[model samples]
Target: MPELLSPRIDAISFRQLRLFESVGRLCSVRRGSEECNLSQPAVTQSLAKLEQMIGVELFERRPSGSYLTPLGRILYSRVVRMLKQMVTALFELEVPGGQVGAEAIVHRLTRSQVRSLVAIIEHGTFAAAAAALQITEGSLQRAARDLECNLRKNILFRSADGVIVTPAGIACGRRMSLALQEIDWAINEIDVARDIGESRIVIGALPFGGSVLLASMLDEFLATQSKVDVRIATESTSEMMQLLRDGKVDLVIGLTQETVGDDLVSQTLAETPYEVVARRGHPLTGQSHVNHEDLIKYDWVVGMPNSNRRNCFDRLFIDGPKPRTPIATSALLFIRHLLAGSNRLTLMTSYELQHETMLVRVPIDVPLPCPTIGITTRADWLPTALHRDFINLIKSRVNTRSIMGVTRTAA
Candidate 1:
């Protein structure tokens, strides 16, 4: 894997990949050369160099013609898809108003420069990011500077604390990160196609979706598709949004907000209502109607500050003084343990408490609005075939009824 991701491996030009793809498609060096407008000798030498660098026999040469080896077939498919994505990215980056300089800037930007910018943003400091990339701070600085010059934007500003990324810089880094992810996804897809290893999908799971929807779908998905890897991250919506923007997360499964940015696309699967819950034998368990005054008498365990759940919790006491949040966290497991051992109250989705024997939903009719739960992905994201299949599976598992009492389409 290290060898595959080495700088030497990445240094293989897009032109080389295009040539190799043409050769594989045509199944003959002479024909590929004719199609790509290159001499047969040049094509042969380029393919030979590519094979040597990858340390694989891509083609079997014979008197009749050239044919792809098993490895060559796998790489050919990946190269085709990757080249197509590259062309699509170029088209997407093109300025609609016919700015020639924008196209030039896109061409000038390299993978390494984009990588350095993303690394700096992720690691929080240039020195730390340089250490992670195993490059000198000066080299990283130069890459950032070159990227800024190419884009004609001030990407970063130096402060006494550290470097601060401008809003424009964050936007640029997000696009670059997404582009790099597309390349990596293609490589991983090729590996999976060859049965070399499992392809991984990283999902940012918010509390509701993790506990309800994905919890039911993951086991079946993994059991049936053994060659695919699934990673679930439970985080606040804001944090998950950042991860999605940076391409660290393939998709987010959670409650959908009323207003999402233009860059993100949301699919509403179902409407999920929040319910008050406590220990089974707790005093509030049998209450026919528990009001905010009754719930405020005891200590509360709530979601993280500024979270959707916390916001809803705060609104419960909007006309009165806010209740004390003795313990504020986002971990559902911890919340369960904390509620079971003590007389504390917390709000969660009904699905979250379905499998828990220790916690029971309080019979309080809280008048909070139900939020729509579903999947969130980048508007420009090009999902692989496997990703599309998994997403469809998730959609199949979700119930269509909206919590707001209306039947809405999943889309």
Candidate 2:
């Protein structure tokens, strides 16, 4: 954003990182300087700053040339991928300036300008975007203006409906968001390996996604991974799916979708069988075998509408009378408490109620299907070494639980 970023001289800059990538590719500081059209001394100084900032030496300086350090090679892969995404985004910005291709566009734009435009698009208002970035509104506007002036295109203009982004701006902002995603992953990969800066990973979990596995692992992860920032999103499956696609979440842990999109990949960890349940002393608790007719006589609680579990609940009585569903909720804690207090029944999995003492199975003879619990990540996702190990640990734990004789549960 500055000749070098301010507020923190050690902060990463897109320009400096691009230079680092150049040197990594050429394996010669002089060649990197020539390719970037910068003085060799300036290139060396920028690389030094980057190395100091990351607390790791990226290159082995020698008379012949520069060579990558061990960590540098691991980091180089992510940076290369990041630049490729940026190049693709630049190519897509052929609108507004039909004469400017990716080659020309990359030369004309600055990281700050792209940052401002992306902020505007994401927040829908310059004021909000500025606040989000912790910068002045005037500075944000100036950056956006410079972007338009450089490209000779009006990215945004005031209309009766308020500010409107031109098609070029929309395209640029959309693609840049994706490019920024690569940047995020790159940084996450570095921080995790270096263990010096904060590493962040967001996990999206559906309501019944064998999230209990997360509880035990979460405790150990927090106790151990102090520098790693972990965020869990317990939103609906659809919301989580969209988040995963957009790179807002690192991965999703949930019921395996019936059909995964081409851009997504899923792995089955375990299958849990679903069971109809009621309070320990409920009338249906003593039934040797209960049918839909007997079960519908009392009030019940079910999962959120349209959820896989709820859909399965619907099929239980597909042939006849519907039960009086007094409540519909996805929160297991609330469901357990509500069932304990009322005569209401519910459909649940053994894994979900593993430690509960009040609820017991309402034995039924129907052919119940089980849900497969697993992890879903972007097909393009490239996890850091540590990240991959963590996911593997989850899979292994689920399998171990199954081996220990935990019943397979269902959605």
Global lDDT of each candidate: 0.73, 0.75
Worst 10 residues of 2 by lDDT: 1-10
Instruction: For model 2, name the residue pairs that clash.
Output: 272-408, 272-409, 272-410, 273-408, 273-409, 273-410, 274-410, 371-410
Writing each residue's lDDT as its tens digit, candidate 1 over 1-411 gives 223444544666656777898889888999999988989999999999988766668899998889998778767766665554444444444433235555445545676777888788788899999999999999999988887776666778989987767765666565655555544565555556656757678888887545467887888788768776678877777888888876778889888866669989998887777777788788876666888778778888988877878888888777886667878888888898998898898887655655567887776665765767889998877777678888989888776553333221111
Global fold similarity of model 1 (TM-score): 0.74
lDDT of 1 at 411: 17
User: Which lDDT value does model 2 have at 121?
Assistant: 82
lDDT (Cα, tens digit) per residue for candidate 2, span 167-198: 77777676676666655555555556765566
For candidate 2, the lDDT comes to 0.75
TM-score of each: 0.74, 0.82
Clashes of each: 1, 8
